[model samples]
Structures are given as structure tokens and as C-alpha cells.
Target: MRRNTGVFIAFAIVFCWFALLTFLLQFPTVFTEPWPYILLLLQTHLYTGLFITAHDAMHGVAAPGNIKLNTVIGFVCALLFAFNWYPRLLPKHHQHHHFVATEKDPDYHGGNFWAWYLSFLKQYITWPQMLAMALTFNILTYFFPLENVVLYWMLPAVLATFQLFYFGTYQPHKGEHNAENKHRSTTLKRNHVWAFISCYFFGYHYEHHDKPFLPWWKLYQEKDRSFK
Candidate 1:
């Protein structure tokens, strides 16, 4: 049931992103009110959801038994989220898991926030991705208001990178680990609501390094699991 639900949520996340965009991209009076700022934050969150779903796909949790369907969902999610290429993200993510905070971890760059974020971007961003985004942006302008596209579409995606980086990667992996911290990872103090709002419970990250096959939605359960 957990695996089946994850597969369904994977598609739901992708659909919600597009459904929200379709409404917000032409939303009236976007910049004229404080409510639109809330919309921006919500959109940014959905954008992060896109990446989180793709990350689950990489772990084979998003569509456990169907390889082709799983990869397709991930490919679509990543492509829509600023044209990120799923194939490229696969190996680097596993490398991060294998190496944790070591030099071989593509997501790590010591404890400096700026340095680590730049490294994270460099590890994932490519010229072709940038070019594809640019082309898509230009094409969208012909159909949607430039203000709406910039605010609802582009800005949230940019903010979501910071959101994902800060919560999912930087906080969890930065700084020194205690002697018994086998994964060299840190789990956030228990706050299930904030954990989900922050990064789909990715802040329960030590549990993640301990059980990589679990989907992002299940991290909270792992975070609260009992031991003998």
C-alpha cells in the first residue's frame, strides 16, 4: 500500500504543479495584493515537490515495480522544474548517498552555506538545461502575460532551489558529525508539519540515509519509528 500510494502521489505532484501553473500564470492582479505573495510561496513549494518526487523516482520508490513509468514521471517532473535532466541527477544522488559528507558527495561542500549551494548548483545545472529553460520561457511569453510568467512560473522555481538546498541538503549534511553518526547526517528535531512544509520531511534526513528506499512522504514515519 505504501509503494502504491507513493506511485500515485508521484503523478499527483506533477499534475498539481501544472494545474496550479495553468491558473496562476494568468491570475489577475498578481502584484497588486499581499495574497499573491502567498500564491508565490505556495507555487515555490509545489516546485520543490517536483524535485522531491523526482528524488523518490531515483530511489525507485515513486513507482517501485515499473522502471519505465518511474523514469518517465521523474523525467517529466525534472524537465518542468527548470528543465533539469533526470538522467544526470541519478548518479550524483547515489554518489551523495554512498559518500555522505566526503569529497565524493556531489551535494556536499563543507559547512559554508554559500559555497555548498554553489557546489550543489554546479553539480546539477548544465548549459543544455539553461538553454531549454530559456527557450521555454521565450515561448511562454507569446501565450501568457510576461508578468504572470515571471512571477508565477519563473520566480518560484528560482526560490525553490534555495528552499530545497537549504532544508534538504545544507542543514542535513553541513558541519561535523558526532562519532556515532554513521551516515554523517543530521535529522531535524521532531516537527512533522514544519518537516513537510520545509522539504517534504527531507529534514528527517538521517532516517533517509539509513533507509534510502523509502519515499519522501514516508520519512516522517521513519523519523518516529520505534527500535527494540
Candidate 2:
């Protein structure tokens, strides 16, 4: 089987980044200073990255030709982000691709943003997972500063759900873009910085539908391609 070097690099980078953020959050001075808030924001993006990495695995591109490795990577990433059920996510995500923005799509929502977000949460959030997360939070806070645990570990995962919804799901598939694109998705106009910041260029939603195999880091290259 051919090696997916890029996927390996992307996974390594995200894992190392998560580790770095954990280290900074654990440090006494960093936890006490104003930097923890900024780190929390950065960690939110990293959490988004982990989700996207798992997403890439779902498409079989993250660790191409190595199903076991891909599954392990996706499961670990999702688990770290407080989502424990990768098996449940995998099939539902495939259904979303097949019936995108329609009633059949697990993520589909034709109404208000909050309502849609609530629906999305309802489908995935489980009682056991919440209890596990709460228990884990209690244990962590016993060892680390409560502020550090809340800001660095808890808040980012919560904010990342919003980030994923707003940038990846709601913004690209809402209103005008939905009407114009057959897939009910549209690409964000070229803006490299924001492109990278917002869901790793998943703002380029149409391009993603066209080439689902492309990894998140390479999605921006589609901006230059003539879709005609």
C-alpha cells in the first residue's frame, strides 16, 4: 500500500500542537497570566483541526490504504476533543455527504442558526459522553487550576463546536450560497488568512464537494482551479 506522507505530517502536527497547548496551560505562570485566554482561542482552532483531521480520515485520505491506522487516528482525535463516538459519527457523516442539506442529512437545517445547531447537537450528544466529560473535568481540576481546566480544556471544545458549525456548516450552506450551488454549498472568496483560520478552507465548500479526497491543508489550492 502507498504511504500517505502528508496525512502523517498533518496528524503529527496536530498532535504536537495539542501537546504544546497542554504544556503551556499546565505551566504555573502561563495559567495565571492573560496568555491563557489567548491560548484557549488558539486551542479552539486546534480542536477544529483535530475534527477536520478526523473528517479527512472519514474520506479515506488521512491515512490512505491503512484502514486500521486511519480509524485509530480519527477515533483518538475525536476522543481528545470530547467526542467519544467515532463509529457513530462515521456513518452519519457519510449520509450527510449523500443527502447534503436535505432533510435526510444529519446536519441539514432550513431554519434559524440556533435551532439548527441544537438539532445537530441532539443527534450526536450522548448522556454517557457528558457524564464521562464531567467526571474527567472534575479529576483534572483537582490537579490543575480550575481556570486552566475550564479555559484550556473545556472552553475550547465548546467553542470549537460553534466554530465548526458557523464556518463549515452554517455560513457556507446558508441562504444565497444554498440557492446558487446545487450542492447547497459555496466557496468563500479568496482570502488566504481567513481561509486558513475558518475551518481550514472548508469555507471552500463547493471545492470540497468536488474533491472530497483532498486534505484540509491542500483545500486552498482549489481556489485557483477553474470549476467550469
Question: Number of the top candidate by TM-score?
Answer: 1
10-106 per-residue lDDT for model 2 (tens digits):
5685776678667855866554568767777788888888888888888877888878888888888777778558898899999988988888999
* Candidate 2 clash pair list: none
For residue 70, what is the lDDT in candidate 1?
87
lDDT by residue (185-216, candidate 1, tens digit) is: 88898889999999999999899999999889
Local distance difference test, each candidate: 0.88, 0.80
Best by lDDT: 1
List runs of model 2 lying over 4 Å from the truth. 29-34, 176-180
**TM values, all candidates:** 0.95, 0.91
Native-vs-model 2 lDDT? 0.80
